[model samples]
Target: MTVSDQTLSTAGTEVADGIVLTDVAASKVRSLLEQEGRTDLQLRVAVQPGGCSGLRYQLFFDERALDGDIVKKFGGVGVVVDRMSAPYLTGAVIDFTDTIEKQGFTIDNPNAQNSCACGDSFH
Candidate 1:
């Protein structure tokens, strides 16, 4: 189903299901792609283990999708999540923020039963 136009910003973009891309995040990603001079790259989100909280978040730019990947498109951007990471990321919202103390992409995940104090890891 198409998202309601009223829920979108002036850019005519709608936030994805359980996900969001703040204006700051979208601009940052766009700038990065421009600087890299590669228009084919897309953001890939994944879950891995290595943090004190038991699970860690992984974000990267990739040009191709591997087997068993779930793909979602938002505002002309492609987001890919692998099979293993799907459950953990379900109902998660992704946003970008630029505050005096922090500046980067952030994920608001409802599925996290526990998270590290630094907010970099989850369980």
Candidate 2:
């Protein structure tokens, strides 16, 4: 696994098979962490069995590392993926956008055969 300071979707680096964190997302995460005054926290990405598409993604700040967790660092941000969710999230690229239509994080998952219209769940 390699970490790069460059933005995602470029020839920068690949941290894992399917999980790529874009530069914008990393910067946003860092900004959020600074606002929260917590430097020990890491971004936890997980897949839960719910949502309209049968599986939903969970992203949050967590300080604890559970067993079988895969941790990858991009710049000053750390992305933690659980063992079970790795397969489902493999080849997924996470990005953040702030435009007039959308203003939040987005996930692009190649392993997903289908996703809901709400863009919150996938199968």
Candidate 3:
């Protein structure tokens, strides 16, 4: 999809294609990128094995894109997902939440059939 600057401007507070980034999540990522002084970094999300549920979620900052990767932009941030993990992450939303009991980024994935109690693993 074609994302304009205006679209990214509203991303922190709006949901698009069933995916979204909360203000806190966006801010945290932006801050880290600023500190690193790298404007090429992108948020990379993927699904891998080795969890209780047979699959685990992976999130990190990356600067490279592989062939066949699906790239998306939101709120001036780039999101990259490899072909192998795209099916599992489609329609998933990434957000940040700070609560008394927990604080961090979270993924709301509709494609998940089962998730482990720890909330880090899914299948």
- Flag regions of model 3 displaced more than 4 Å: 1-18
- What is the Cα-based TM-score of model 3? 0.82
lDDT of 1 by residue, 1-123 (tens): 121222345453345544555565666777887899988887889999979899999999998868887766655566777878888887787777778998888998999999999898999
RMSD in order of candidates: 4.4, 3.4, 3.0
Kindly report which residue stretches of model 1 are placed more than 4 angstroms away from their true locations once superposed. Answer: 1-18
Worst 10 residues of 2 by lDDT: 1-10
**How close to the true structure is residue 62 of candidate 2, measured as C-alpha lDDT?**
96
Report the C-alpha displacement of residue 110, candidate 2, in angstroms. Answer: 0.1
**Best model number under TM-score:** 2
Give the winner by lDDT: 2 or 3. Answer: 2
Q: Tens-digit lDDT track for model 2 on 1-123?
A: 232344344654345556888888889999999999999999999999999989999999999878888888776798888889999888898889899999999888888999999888998
Worst 10 residues of 1 by lDDT: 1-10
- Give per-model TM-scores: 0.81, 0.88, 0.82
Candidate 3's residue-wise lDDT over 8-99, tens digit each?
33634544444566666777788878999999898888889978999998989998878876666665677777878878876787887779
lDDT of 1: 0.74
Flag the better candidate by TM-score, 1 or 3.
3
